[model samples]
Target: MSDAQFVQIVGAVYEHSPWVAERVVSQRPFASAEALRSAMRRAVQQAGEAQQIKLVRAHPELAGTAAARGEMTAASTSEQGGAGLNQLTPEELARLQSLNARYSEKFGFPFVMAVRGHDRQAIFAAMTQRLNNDRDTELRNSLEQIDRVVSFRLNDLISG
Candidate 1:
């Protein structure tokens, strides 16, 4: 496939960051799904701190304003909803909002987790516990979470 066509298929695997796909276009014809995954991840790793931060910032806060106003991307909406975030009670919503605010305030980016396979309680615990981490640790953790999310997305897009 042409580069544009390839990107159109997988560009969104990394949330709003199509650059991740674009960056690896020159390295096409990956021998296997794992190679494609590795190339995409290496692009992010080599993208430098500013770009990496921007990529992380592109993710919507879980159950944050984007979810409230119905603005999150379809993938995010599905993932969040699958975690029962779309069905939070008022108290739970309020608590989550508070946690999100505090976490964002401290880290300058929304808390991220690969919400699939996790319920609301697990998500909350992770957010709360991660709040104690230093910026470097949290940034690394967020990127790792993004990788997990991307892996799921890639799996859905690619088949054996």
Candidate 2:
């Protein structure tokens, strides 16, 4: 893929961090979709603890202010919408915000998830369960979710 297209494809995959794509652009002519994904994963891994947290935090809370105001990226909007986060009732939105505030307070980052096959109940259950985890564990889980999100994006934009 051309440089611009490469960035266009993977940039939103990493939340607002186009630098992830920019950093990996020179390593292009990716052998396969998985190869491209691994390169993106390594970019996050190499970013170290602080940067990793920053990247995770770059994501807006599901059905929160960004979604309500329509300020989220198109990819994020669609992902959250797919999970039914976009259609929450006021009570549901309040519950999610309460959970989100608690989760962020505990982990210092927003709860991250792929949200493809998940519904609001599953998401709330996961959020409540994940809140019990220690910081490091939650961070690892966040990275795994980010990987899943990236993979989904790659599968959408790139073909093997």
**lDDT leader:** 1
lDDT tens readout by residue for model 2, 1-160: 6898878767867888898998889997789888888998998899899989999999999888888788998888989999999889989999999999999999899999999989999999999999999999999999999999989987987653
Could you give me the TM-score of model 1 versus the true structure?
A: 0.97
Model 2 spans with C-alpha error above 4 angstroms: 1-5
Candidate 1 lDDT by residue in tens digits, 133-153: 999999999999999999998
The list of candidate 1 runs beyond 4 A from truth reads: none
**Ten contiguous residues minimizing lDDT sum, candidate 1:** 151-160
Return the lDDT, model 2, position 140.
97
Error at 156, model 2, angstroms? 0.8
Q: Check candidate 2 and list the clashing pairs.
A: none
The whole-model lDDT of each prediction reads 0.93, 0.90
